[model samples]
Target chain A: MQRYKGIVAYDGSGFSGYQIQPNGRTVQEEIEKALGKMHKGKPVSIVASGRTDAGVHAKRQVIHFDSALQLPSERWVKAVNGLLPGDISVMQVDAVSSDFHARFDASGKTYKYVVYTGSIRDPFKRHYAAHYPYKIDIAKVKKASEFLTGTHDFTSFCSAKTEMEKKVRTVTNISIEQNTDEIVFTFTGNGFLYNMVRIMVGTMLDVGTGKIELQTIPSILTGRDRTLAGKTAPAEGLYLWEVYY
Target chain B: MQRYKGIVAYDGSGFSGYQIQPNGRTVQEEIEKALGKMHKGKPVSIVASGRTDAGVHAKRQVIHFDSALQLPSERWVKAVNGLLPGDISVMQVDAVSSDFHARFDASGKTYKYVVYTGSIRDPFKRHYAAHYPYKIDIAKVKKASEFLTGTHDFTSFCSAKTEMEKKVRTVTNISIEQNTDEIVFTFTGNGFLYNMVRIMVGTMLDVGTGKIELQTIPSILTGRDRTLAGKTAPAEGLYLWEVYY
Candidate 1:
């Protein structure tokens, strides 16, 4: 069997999450089902770079799987996409070394969170962006994000449900871009715990709106308490942008 | 009684059309239903600039209705939007003259059609753009659009289902904007017949792909034969952008 790596994109609006569960539909289930068809009733499992929560979209999620089929790269993409739902797409595929892994070899990840600040809600963007009705100070938001950059323990910015033992992660970058009525926050890090990005955004929003002191982020990180941070931002606004190997 | 003019936008994916129908839900029905609720079960009607076919979106559709309530403009927008579905939004509302009409007083309208030319299909844009797999010549499309500008008898570019007595209309502007993997065709005209903009776009696409001669647009307009033009483009790519008074 040959191992193959692929880049996939999904809308995530209809998916329960990226991982398979007992009842709810998932991105992994749909992709595996499609692969099973290609394998003629033989089940094929896939390993993703990581799991995304429900309603979290991905622009270029990486995955790997083993297959006996000897199809070309484009043919694999076409065959798999033909069987997949319209909300999920297989963008490209390439043969990789047999030992290459999607999850283990990953070096870093980039995620983007979109916030819509329009007073008038936009229907087209309802599913894509998190609507923030309150006025935000961009200068304060920028100042607070500086405390989040670089290596730090992100325990306070992680969900209580996270089972990972390592609460420490290296955040290499945090950038904020503001347009007319939208603010996009981009984060690049070695790894993120469950709901880390969303929790960070929520905490930053608190600082941006002057609810929390700007200098409190460092204390919150050292506090290592989930309750000390702000609420977890909604899943719909978060996007897994890319994975580095 | 007071007259209110409102600007509304809708995703149109879940809507059957903009007009009321027997079985399928429509934008008009949703708005009227909201108005009925606000008026305490008293039936209310609305007049739109025109009706869009099933799956056609609208960025700024104008409508006028008569009501006895004297709420502020923002209140009207918020109240109606609260009752409407997530796909439909009332952006703004204003009190207008009782004699003003949404359909009769319209002087011109603008429509936009988006075509996606990416080799890999995008799931997020599947419902918002028409995917044309073939390579297109944008220069040819621009040249053909020039012939379609100004006054002309556009019967060949209109649907045979039209019941209007006169098919003569003046197309004031036809602009084409091409980006990395998509093309947007914007048409501004005094009026359009049934499926006029879609048919015109379809014909231009044929010319763009060398399926039809570039110079034949004039003859197609003058011939007034529906069969001479290309097929009507899909409705999902079309958007009613604006209606001017």
Candidate 2:
């Protein structure tokens, strides 16, 4: 079987998360179903870069699958996109070495969270961004983000129910871009723990609102306790922007 | 009674049209319903700048209504928006003179039509733009649009089913903006015949595709026959961009 790699984009609003479930639909289920059709009803399995939570969109999520069919790269993209729903699309596809793995071979990742800080909700972006009706001190948030950059123990930012024992991750970069009433927070890291990006954004928002001191981020990181972090941001605002390999 | 003017925005995907009908829902029906709720079912009527065909959006549709309720401009905007559906929104409101009219007093209007010219359909913009898979010669379209600008007998562009006898209209400006895979056509005119803008765009598309010759536009206009023009473009790609008084 030849292995194929692809970049997929999806609006995750209709999904019950990326993973397959007994009830409701999923991105994986749709792709696999499409693959099954391409394979003449034989079940085909595929692996994605990672599982995005429900309501979290992806600009380019990577994936890999094996197939005996020998369609060209562009044809695979067209065929898969034809079978997928309107909310999910295959952007590009290419042949990959048999040894290549979508999840394990990933070198880094980037994610973006969009926050709309407007008094009244913007009708155009209502479905894509998180609406925060209060003003945010952008400078304070930037200062707080500085503490989040670089290699550190991100256990405090992770979800409390996470089962992973190793919470140390290397954060490569963090930047906050403010455009009009929307604030976009981009995070690039070697890897992320469950809910880490959302928790970090929540804590930074707390700093912006003066609820958490800007200088307290280092202490919170050192604390390595999820309770020290602020509440998790909503999933709709988060996007899996890129997967680097 | 106080006369109030407001700027409204709507997605128009769910609306049947801008005019009220017995069996179908429209933007006019929604706003009037909202107004009735505010007036305790007193049944308030409003007039818009003009009617938008079904599936045509409005970025800033001007509307006027006379109300007995004593509310400030901002309050009227907020209250009406609260009562309106999520697809429709009131952007701004102001008190207008008693003699002011939404339809009759308007001197000009601007409409925009969006076309996505890419091999792959953009799922995100599926609701907002019309997708054209074939490539278009933009320079040719620009050349054709030049002939269409200024005063002319636009009978060839109007819908054949239209009841109006006076098909002449003054086209003040026409501009085309291309960005990435999308092209936007903006039309500012003193007035437009029924389906005039759509027919013009369709003819321009034909010119861009080499189906219609550039020099044929003037002759087509002189023909003063609806059958001589290109087909009417779909309503989903059209937007009432602005109205001038």
Candidate 3:
């Protein structure tokens, strides 16, 4: 058996999430189905670096799958892309060691959340960005982002139904950047809990809008209650930027 | 009466381009309908810098309209934005002289056509760019762009159904740039004939793909027949970049 690693990019608008679900379509199921057809009806299963929720996009998502056929790297890239829908593309494919797993071998991951804070909505950017018409204090948001960084138990920032036994995760880097009319929040971490990044972005927005104080971040983490945090931002504005090993 | 000039942007995936068409919804019609509602049932007509064909996008399209009510600039911006659909946006609004006309007073217009030349389709960019799964000779396209620059009678580039009496147009600049996997064609001209920009891009692509030699450009222009030129490119990839007066 040959293990192939692929880098993928997708528009998550039509997906129910990364993992398979009974109610709606998923990126994994679509890719697996396409792969199965390419492998002569042989079913194939893929493991991803991380699972992204519905309406979230990905610029570069890593995945691994084992196939009995020894196909060339270029053939794997082209064959899978030809069968997949227009919203999904395999950017690169390479043969990796059999033991190199996509999810298990990953050291860290990066995500970006885009917010369009202009007074007027930009129709061209509507699907790619979250529109917030309220004026925000950038300084406060920056301060709050610093407080959220470093190792901590991020229970407040995670969804309440998270199945992970340990709520502690290390956020290595956090950045808040403002361009002409957009605000971007970038986070890099060892791992993320369910809905952690979205909740963190929401809480930071609350700080920028003066709904919450900058000093409240530490206490929010200590509270370990999802309700103590701000509302989770919509999934459309979030993107899986990259996966690092 | 006060004349207001506004800069607009739109994702043309939803509308029938910038002109008002009888059979389909148009960017102009939508904005005008919203303006009429704001003016208490009085219909308003807006004149744009130029007419864009169906499915063409715009980054900055200039337009002018007359209104009897002395509405504050902010209120006008907010009211129109409040009623317009998410596909179109009014980026800026300013008071202009009554003599100012968006079409007749325009000195130059710029357009950009984006082509994704990679083998795989980019799902996120499906509606925004043209996907050409073929290898192109970038050097030949760049040389052909140079040949297209300068004042000339672009009769062959104009669509056969164009209503203009004179096909003489001044192409001030033509630039073909390739960045990684995408090719961008930018053109600046005194004015473009109906479907002229799309035809130019198509002709250039033919040269880049070696379907037609670079030397064929002058002959295509001299022939003065639309059939001599290459096929007209699709409208989805074309963007009205800006207008200068």
Model 2 residue B230 lDDT score: 87
Q: List the global CA lDDT of all models.
A: 0.93, 0.89, 0.90
* iRMSD for every model: 0.7, 1.8, 1.6
- Candidate 1, A125-178: lDDT as tens digits: 887999897899999999988999988888898988788888899989999999
DockQ of each: 0.85, 0.43, 0.66
Model 2, runs deviating above 4 Å: B22-25
- Give the TM-score of chain A in candidate 1: 0.98
lDDT of 1 by residue, B135-227 (tens): 999999999999999999988998887789899999999999999999999999999999999999999999999999998889998999999
Task: Residues B67-87, candidate 3: write the lDDT tens digits.
Answer: 997877787878898989988
* Top candidate, metric TM-score: 1
In model 3, what are the clashing residue pairs, if there are any?
A: A86-B123
Off by over 4 Å in 1: none
Model 3 clashing-pair count: 1
Best by DockQ: 1
